[model samples]
Target chain A: MLKTRIIPCLDVIKNKVVKGVNFKNIKVMGNAVEMARYYSLSGADELCMLDINASYQNRKTFIKTVEAIAKVINIPLTVGGGISVLDDITDLLNAGADKVSINSAAVKNPKLIRQASIKHGSQCIVVAIDGKRHENKMKVVVKGGREITKKELIVWAKEVQSLGAGEILMTSMDTDGVQNGFDSSMLKKVTSNVSIPVIASGGVGNLEHFYLGHLTKSTGLLAASVFHSGKYKIKSVKKYLKNKGVPVRL
Target chain B: MKKKVIGLIDGQSGNIGSINKAIKEIIKGRPYQLKIIKGEFDNSLFSKIILPGQGAYATLISNLKKLKIYKPLKKYLDNNRSYLGICVGMQILSDQGHEDKTTKGLGIIAGEIKKFKSKKLIIPHMGWNSIRLNKEDPIITNNLDNKDFYFVHSYIFQNIKKSNVLANTHYGKKFPSIIKKGNIYGVQFHPEKSHKYGLNLIKNYILKS
Candidate 1:
C-alpha cells in the first residue's frame, strides 16, 4: 500500500518564505532554502514552493531559490506560481523541479495543460485549483482567490484530469489561513470523482487536522501556517497518522 | 593507474539533479570519479554507466540521438558492461514504449512498455510503495527486503521474462520494480529520491559491483 504524503507549502517571495492570514497580512519566516531544508530533513515527503512575488525581478530570485533547494534536498520538489506557458514549466523542471503546478493558466487556456503534459509527461504536471464556498457550492476562484468563476470546483477538477493532469492540488480559499481544518466534504467530492491523486491544501492547525485531511481520501496533506510558524512538527504528524492506522512513513 | 570513473549520461532529457547529488554523496571517500556524460562519450573511459531520466520516452531517445550517444549506449549494453537505468531510463531499455505514441526503445531486453491498466488505481503510481523481492541480486537488493521505495510513473514493462525481474511491486497488479539482465540493471523507482533504502541500493551498485 502507498503511504500518505505530508507536504509543506511554502509561499516564497524574493527567496524568502512568507505566511499570510487569509492570504494577506504577510509575514516573513526566514530564508526559503533554509526553511525548505529543515522540512525535507524532518519528515516532509515532498515540498511545494509557490512564488508569491509579483515583480519580474523577484521571479528570477525564486528560480534561483529552487535550484539552491534542489541541491541540498533529495526529495521531490514541486514549483508553482505564475507558470503560464510550457516554457515556464520547462524552466522549472530544468532547474531541478520534479513537477510544475499550473493554476490560472490551465483555467484560462486549457490547451496549456494539454501542451505541457504532452511535451513533458503528465506525471510532472500538477493542476492546482483554488476554490471558495459560494452559496452552498464550491466555486473555482483564480488570481489567488480574489476572483470567482462560473466553473465549479468538481467540474474543473475532472476537466483537468481529462486534459492530462497527473495530480490536483485543491485548496479551500474559505478555510485557508483560518487554520481550522481542511474542507473534508469538498475534498471528498473531488477525490471520489477523480482518479488522480488529490493533495488537500489550505487549512491545518493541529495533528488531528492532518488526520482528518488523510481521512478525506487525499493522498497528501499540505499546510502553510502550522508548518511555517513551527507549531506542529512534521515528525509528530507522521507519527500521529501512523498511530491512527493511516499508513504514513515514520 | 587512472581512477575508475562512473559515467552518468545526461542527454538533456530531463532533471538529473537529485541523482547527481546522490552519486556525489555516495562516492565521497570511494575510489571512483563521477563523470556527467553530456555530448559524446568514449565508452572505454568508464567502468560503469548510469542513465537517469524523467519525462516522455520519445523525448528521451530523441535527446540521446541528438547527443550522439545512442550508438555508444547500445554498444555499452551489448558488451554487458555494468549499467543501471532509473525511471524512464529503465522503460527505454525494452523494445518499445507506448507513451503519447509508440516509441522505439533500445531493445537491450525482451519486453514492451505498456501503461498500467487498473480501474481501481490512479494512472501515475506516485508515492512510497513497498516492493516484494522475487530473488536476491547483490547490487539491486542488498540489505533491502520488504522495504518501500519512492515511485512516480504511469507505464511499466509488461511480459518481461521471469528471470529478468529482480523485484516487483503491486499497484493493481504486480509490475517489475527492478529488472536485471546480465550486467544491465534497471529500476522503476528513483533510488536518489527514496531516502535511506534507495541510497543503500545505489551505494551497493557503486561499491560492491
Candidate 2:
C-alpha cells in the first residue's frame, strides 16, 4: 500500500528558503541546496520548493538552485511559485525538478494544465490551490494569495483534475503559517471532491496535526514552519505518524 | 576490463535529470559510463539500458516512435541485455497499454498495462510503497525484495505472465511492481528517487547485474 508522505516545503525567494505569513513578510530560512539536502537525508518523503518570487532574474537562480538540490538529493523534488508558462515548466524540469506545481498560471489558463499534462504527463503537473474562506464559502486565491479568484475551491479543484492534473496541493490561506494546525476540514472537503491525491498544506503545528493529516483525505501532508523552525525533524514526524497507525515510510 | 557503457534512453517526453544525476553520482570513480541516448542509438554500444519515461501511454509510445528508437529498443531488449525501466519506462515493456487508448508496448515481458480497477484508493498510486518479492536473482543482484520504493502511476501490469513477475506491491490489489524476463528488469517505482534503498538497487544493477 502507498504510505502517507511527509513533505517539508521550503518557500524560495531569490534562491533562498524563506517563510511568510499569509504569503507576505518573507523571511529567509537558509541556503536552498543545503536545507533541501538536509531534508532528503532526514527522511523527508518528498521535498517541495516554491519559487515564491519567480522573476526574470530569480528564474535563473531558482533553476540553478533546483539543479544544485537535485545533485545533492536523491528524493523527488517539486518546484512551484510563479510558474506561468510552458517554457518555465520545461526549464524547471530540465533543471532537475521531478514535478512543477502551478497556481496562478493554472487558474488564469486552465488549458495550461491540460497542455502541460499532455506535454509532460499528468503525474508531473501538480495544480496548487490556495483557498481562503471569504464570507462563508471557500474561494480560490492565486498570485501568492494576494488575489482571490471567483472560482470556488472544490469546483476549481475538480476542474483541474478533469483537466488532467495528477495531484492537488491545497493550501489554506487563513491558517497558513499560523502554526495552529492543518486546515483538516477544508483539506478533507477538497480531498473528498477530487479523485487524485491531495496534499494538505498551510497549517501544521504538532504531531497531532500531522496525525490528523493521515486521518483526512490528503495522502501527502506538508508542514513548513515546524520543519523550517527546527522544532520537529521529518524522521520524528514520520515515526510519530507511523506509531499512530498511519502508513509511513521509515 | 571492458568499459561498461550505460545508455539512458531519452524519448524527449520524460524527465531524466534526477535519474541522470543519481546514476552519475553512483558511478563516480567507477568503470561505468552514462550516455543519454536521445535520437537513434546503436543498441550494441550499451552494456546496459535505462529507459525512464512519464505521461500517457500513447504519448510515450509516440515519442519513442518519433525518435525512431522504438524498433531498435524493442530489438535490443528482445534478447534481454541488462535493462532498467521506471514508471512509463516499465509500462512500455508490456505487450500493450490500455491508458487512454490501446497502444503497443515493447512486448518484452508478456503483459498489458491497465488502470487500477478499484475505486477505494486513489487512481495514481503515488508515494512510497513496499514490495513483496516473488523471486530472486543470483546474477543480477537487486535487493528490492520487500523494500519500499517510490511509485506514481495509475496503471499496473495486470495481464503480466506469472514468470515475468518479480515483485508485487499491494494497493487495492496485488499488482506487479517489478517484472523481469531474462536480463530485463523493469520496476514501476523510480529507483533513482527512492532514497537510499533505491540508490542501492541501481548500484547493485550497475556493479553486479
Candidate 3:
C-alpha cells in the first residue's frame, strides 16, 4: 500500500525561508538550506518550497538555494511559484529540484503544461490550483487567491491532467490561514475527477486535520502555518497518521 | 593506501545532485571521493559505480549510447564490480523496454520493462510504499526491513527470474522493488530521494568495503 505523505511547505523569498516557520531546529532560521535539512530530518516525506521571490536578478540566488538544499537533504523537493515558462522549469530541475509546480501560468496558458510534460516527463510536472468556494460553487483562483477565474475547479483539474500533469496541488483559499482543516470536499471532487495524485493544501491545523486529509482522496497533505508556527511537528503528524491506521512512512 | 573513487554515471537523463549528496554524506570521513562520470569513463578507474537516471527508457538508453559509454557500461557490469541502478538506470539493465515501443536494453537481466496495467490502479505508481525482502543482501537493502521507500515510476520489470529478485513491493500486484544478481544491483525506487531510509541504502552501498 502507498503511504500517506506529510509535507511541510516553506515559503521562500529572495533565498530566505520566510512566512511562519518557527522551530528551534531551524539553526539558521532564515536559511533555506538549513530549513530544508531540518525538515528532511524531521520525517517530512517531502518538502514543497514556494519561491515567492519575484525578480530577474534573484533568479540565480533561488537556484543556488535549491542547489544548497539538494546538497544537504535526501528528500524530494517540489518547487512552485513564478514558474511561467518551460525554461523556468528546466532551470529549477537543473538546480536540483525533483519536481516543479506550475500555477497561474498554467491557467493563463495551458500549453505550458503540455510543453513542460513533453520536455521533462509528466512525473516532474505538478499543476497547483488555488480554489475558493464562491456562491456554493468552487471556482479556480490565481494570483495567490486574489483573483478569481470563471473556471470550475473540477473542470480545470481534468483539463490539466489531460494536458499531461502528473499531479495536482489543490489549495483552498477559504480554508487557508484559518487553522481549521483542508477543503476535503474540494479535494475529493478534484481527486475523483482525475486519476493522478492530488496534494491537499491549506488549513491544516492539528493532527486530526492531517488525518482528515488522509481520509480524503488526496495522497499527500501539505500545511505551512501549522508546521511553521510549531503547533505540530512533522514526526508527530506522521505518528498520528500511523496510529490512526493510515499507512505512513515512520 | 590510495582512496577509492566511486563513479556516479550521469547520462544527462536528469538531475543527479541528490545521489551525489547522499553518497557524500555517507562517506564523509572515509577516504573515498565521488567522481562524476559525464561521458565515456574507463571501467578500471573506479572501484564501484552508481548509475542514477530518470525520464523515458529509450531516451536514457540512447543517451548512454550517444555518449559512447554503452560498451564500457556493459563491460563494467559484466565484470560484476558492484554496480547499483536507480529507476530508469535499473530499467535499462533489462533485456528490453516496452515503453512506447520495444527498445533494446543492456540485457544484464533477462526481463522486459512493463507499465502497470489495471484501470483501478494509477499509471505512475507514485509515493512511498513498503517492501518485503525476498532474501538478504548486505549491500542492496542492508538491514532495512519492513520500511517504505519513495517510488515514482510507470513501468516495472516483468518476466524476471525469481532468484534475481531481492525484494518485492505491491501496488496492484507484487513487483520487484530490489533486484540483485551477484555484484549487480538495481532498485526501482530512488534511494537518493527516499530521505533517511534512502540515505541508509546509499551508505550501505558506499561503505560496503
The number of the candidate with the highest DockQ is: 2
lDDT of 3 by residue, A143-172 (tens): 768798989989999999999998899988
A96 in model 1: Cα distance from truth in Å? 1.5
Q: Judged by lDDT against the true structure, how good is candidate 1?
A: 0.88
Using DockQ as the measure, name the better of candidate 1 and candidate 3. Answer: 1
| Weakest ten-residue segment in model 2 chain B by summed lDDT | B137-146
In candidate 2, which residue pairs get closer than 3 Å at backbone N, Cα or C atoms, i.e. clash? none
Which lDDT tens digits does candidate 1 get at residues A1-250? 7889999998999789998786688889889999988988897888999987647888888889999999888778999997887889999998889999999989899899999988877888999999989888889999878999999999999999999999999999888888799989889999999999999998899888999999888998898888788888999888888989998876
What overall lDDT goes with each candidate model?
0.88, 0.87, 0.86
The predicted structure with the larger lDDT, 1 or 3, is 1
Give the total clashing residue pairs for model 3: 0
For candidate 2, the docking band is high
Candidate ranking (TM-score, best to worst) = 2, 1, 3
Stretches > 4 Å off in candidate 2: B138-143
Q: Provide the global lDDT of candidate 2 against the true structure.
A: 0.87
Model 3: lDDT of residue B44? 96
What are the per-model DockQ values? Answer: 0.70, 0.86, 0.70
Report, to 2 decimal places, the DockQ of model 1.
Answer: 0.70
Stretches off by above 4 angstroms in model 3 are A20-30, B140-142
The order of the candidates by lDDT, greatest first, is: 1, 2, 3
